[model samples]
Target: MENLTLEMSKNTNTLQEQQLKLIEGNFTKSEALKIINNVVNVKINFHKLQRLSKIEGNVNDKCTYDNSRISELIDDQADMKSFLRSLEVNGKNIKISSTINITVEE
Candidate 1:
C-alpha cells in the first residue's frame, strides 16, 4: 500500500508544458494586417459558433459574454486598421511576436 501511494504521488508531481512561437517576424503593413486579421477572424468565428451552439441547445440564446467579445474584436480590428493606415510608408515593416503556451491544470 505504501509503495502504491508513493508511485501515485510521483505521477501527480509531474508537470507537462508546451510552448509555440507562432509568429515572430517583421512584415510590411499589408502583410501584418493579413496575419492579424486571419488570427482574429478565427477567434471571432469560434465564439460565434459557441454562441450558436448554446442557442441551438436551448442552453441560452443571449450569450452575452460571447456577443461582447465579438463586438470587442470587431472594434479592435477597426482600431488596428486605423493604426496601420497611419503608417507613413506602405513598405514600412512592423514587428510582431506571438507566443502560445499550453499547460495542464492541477
Candidate 2:
C-alpha cells in the first residue's frame, strides 16, 4: 500500500506538470491579434461599402468616382501595415519570455 501510494503521488505530480506545460504552450497572442485585425478590417470594409453604396446608389460608380482617392487608400494600407507590425513585435517579446515546464511519469 505504501509503494502504491508513492507511485500514485508521483503520477499525479507528473500529470499536473504536463497540464501546466500544455496550458503554457497554448498561450499566445500572435494569432489572436491577427484574427482581431482581420475582423476589424472586415467590419470596416463592410461599413465603408454600405456607406458608399448609399451615397452613390451603385458600388461600381463609387469606386470609379473615388479613383482620385487612391493616395488616401494607399496611406490607409500603410498605416494598417504599421499597426500590424507593431502588434507582432510586441507579441513576440511577450511570448519569448514566457516559461513552460513538462514532466512525464515513467
Q: Which ten residues in a row have the lowest lDDT in candidate 1?
A: 1-10
lDDT of 2 by residue, 1-106 (tens): 1111111123354445632221112223554344435544665676577657666755455353443344455456567556655664544422221223456456
Residues 1-106, model 1: lDDT tens digits: 1111111112233457555667777777778788778878998899898877766866545545537899999899888888877888756678877767667887
Please give the RMSD of candidate 2 to the true structure.
17.7
TM-score of 1: 0.72
Question: In model 1, where do residues sit more than 4 Å from their true spots?
Answer: 1-15, 57-66
Top-TM-score candidate index: 1
What lDDT would each prediction earn against the true structure?
Answer: 0.71, 0.44
How does residue 67 of candidate 2 score in lDDT?
38
Query: What clash pairs does model 1 have?
Result: none
